[model samples]
Target: MPGLSLWLSPPPESSLYRALQDLITDLAGSVPAKDAPVFYPHITITSNIPIECDADEVVAFAASHWAADALATVTIMDFGPAFFKKLFLRIRKTPALTQLARECREKYVYGLATAEEGDPADQAAVWAQDEFDPHLSLLYTNSWPFSDEQKAEFGAKVQTVLETHSTEWTGGLLTLVPTYRSVDEWKPLASQLVGSE
Candidate 1:
């Protein structure tokens, strides 16, 4: 059965959120639909929570553990060309961010097993398989091996937009979303604001 996942993202009201949306709009216009698809900015905390995991349980877990503090600041390091990671901002993983991800996986993915905390080897694993390298993706490509020219074009476009802003952003809304379908089909089941009452 398909499952749910946790996503940490900038709330719509934030300037960083608006800037990312604008960048998505600009980039989406140029790429052919078959090449890539636009998506909201997010750093996935955990993917493929068992469908049996109650949505409310997950939301409450996140809220209780993380609501008192804002999410860790994320810095855009560079760009990459992998399919899901196509034209993405590589994020600098901070200790707080790593801890957040580990907690999520412990409760949801590994069923609270200390021995099962996520492994770095899993970083190359597919989406359903777990890892904790955090990044805010800008584009999702349908095809593999995007030509160098195309990748370079996308990189230039990304740099042109992001160069004007600091690479770091902090705080976000945490959401539980069903991950059983296409990107466009996925929607949030519940959400909580970090560091907000």
Candidate 2:
């Protein structure tokens, strides 16, 4: 299987999720107002792989390896927004999440490479190293309605969110995203996280 990566994202009730949604409403006035398909607010647990991976198998593997669900309490304790030209929120690495990522990647995902090894496009993904970046994307690809100064100000505002918002990873859906290399092509694969409540 290929195209399997874990994700940490907002439950509908999350403050951070709402804040970004609010920003989207604000930007609707000026910009075209669509988040990049893969750019919705999410922290990637893993990424970069071929597309033929079995979704159900990946989910089953993750559920089996995890410690019977866990505290969804997560925090983005560090600031200083970084982006690939677009800005994103970064978090200090936590052993719990890192361990979760490694187990899934090494056990389930790593083995799937051979499934797509012969296809030229798939081979590129198999050879590439997918690094984990614990982050929540705040903005991507000039899609927001804010001006440059506004963008700066928007980023600055999020610094406050990073500073004050400590969130509990309450039980929410386990989201799986597809990589047709486009958001339109990607679909969410989800399971309920055993929440902190």
Candidate 3:
């Protein structure tokens, strides 16, 4: 029942990506296994791909439809408290990225369906809840959801590490990842160059 999702990952060759990856690994190491999990640094485009859909078809759809000369420059804006976004860096949005997200949603989520058909009304309602708010999660933790003190402490640690690295993520891979039952189980299914012709 695991669904598919799309993410924009910084080029592995980029220094920024290496720094962020190390930060995530280090932070993930500090938290207990049940509290937080380690994940790659990525700006999620959409995480609503239905489990019923074909992965290869989705990958091909994205490959043919989406093309970007360069991904938006990601800036570490602020911190958040959501479980998936626990101690995360909010990224600045760009027109190209926004458009790309919308197109992906139209295909995978909306399923090219009208308001009255394809998906049931209730199902449609559920899919509509996801909005394209781009962010690069530094930690995925559930322990400090309501603890401001803990969140601030972690945020300070994140800020300290970020200050020593470049925050700009310009371009990378457009990847299709499976959203499994656990973060550790998730992995990329397909990927294409963002700026390739």
Candidate 4:
């Protein structure tokens, strides 16, 4: 089964992009140079188990949700230690984002569910369910449980990096990607600019 996900891709000129590059560069110094995952900065709106839906339908839903705004603004408010097993930049949840997530889940996810569908229960949980603490991951890996001293040192480094950068970004692209295994395998099925025709 293909793993589908919705993502907000930050524009290249945004300060958030530059900050993410800097963070990746700094983090790369901590591990073997080849071990760092290829960086593609984005805030995942939701992830779903391979639902049979038209790609155009998914793109249309995203475009319609943000119809009035030419760009969706995201704020990177703070640096967090870990989420979903990776260090990340915590995003301040805004109503626009929250609503967008809700619509994606309702229209694409839960709306596709059926009683006879063999255990749709195992699909990834919907976003914006209880709390919408959106975040942009800075690192992606399975390694875990660093030594206390190492964690402290790395935490300080991440803090220092955050202090030097701006927090906000205007993302113009919404994409539907299908992944086979790792994030590196994600292939864009369709894309739409936030508000353009």
lDDT, candidate 2, residue 101? 63
Which stretches of model 2 miss by more than 4 angstroms? 1-4, 24-39, 67-85, 114-130, 142-151, 160-171
List model 3 lDDT by residue over 143-189, tens digit each. Answer: 56435665566667777766876666555777878785578877777
- For candidate 2, the per-residue lDDT at 57 reads 64
TM-score of each: 0.79, 0.64, 0.78, 0.72
Better by lDDT, candidate 2 or 1: 1
Candidate 1 structure, TM-score to reference: 0.79
C-alpha RMSD by candidate, in order: 4.8, 6.1, 4.0, 4.7
Better of 2 and 3 by TM-score: 3
Residue-by-residue lDDT tens digits, candidate 1, 134-163 = 888787765556577877787787777678
Residue pairs with clashing backbones, model 4: none
* Candidate 4 residue spans exceeding 4 A from truth: 25-29, 32-36, 49-51, 67-84, 115-127, 195-197
lDDT of each: 0.69, 0.52, 0.70, 0.63
lDDT of 4 at 158: 67
As for candidate 1, its clashing pairs are none
* lDDT over C-alpha atoms for residue 13 of model 2: 73
Which window of ten consecutive residues has the lowest lDDT sum in model 4?
A: 118-127
Model 1 per-residue lDDT at 137: 79
Tens digits of lDDT, candidate 2, 6-94: 66666657776676555533433333445433345556666643456666666666655555344344444232333222555564455
lDDT of 3 at 173: 74
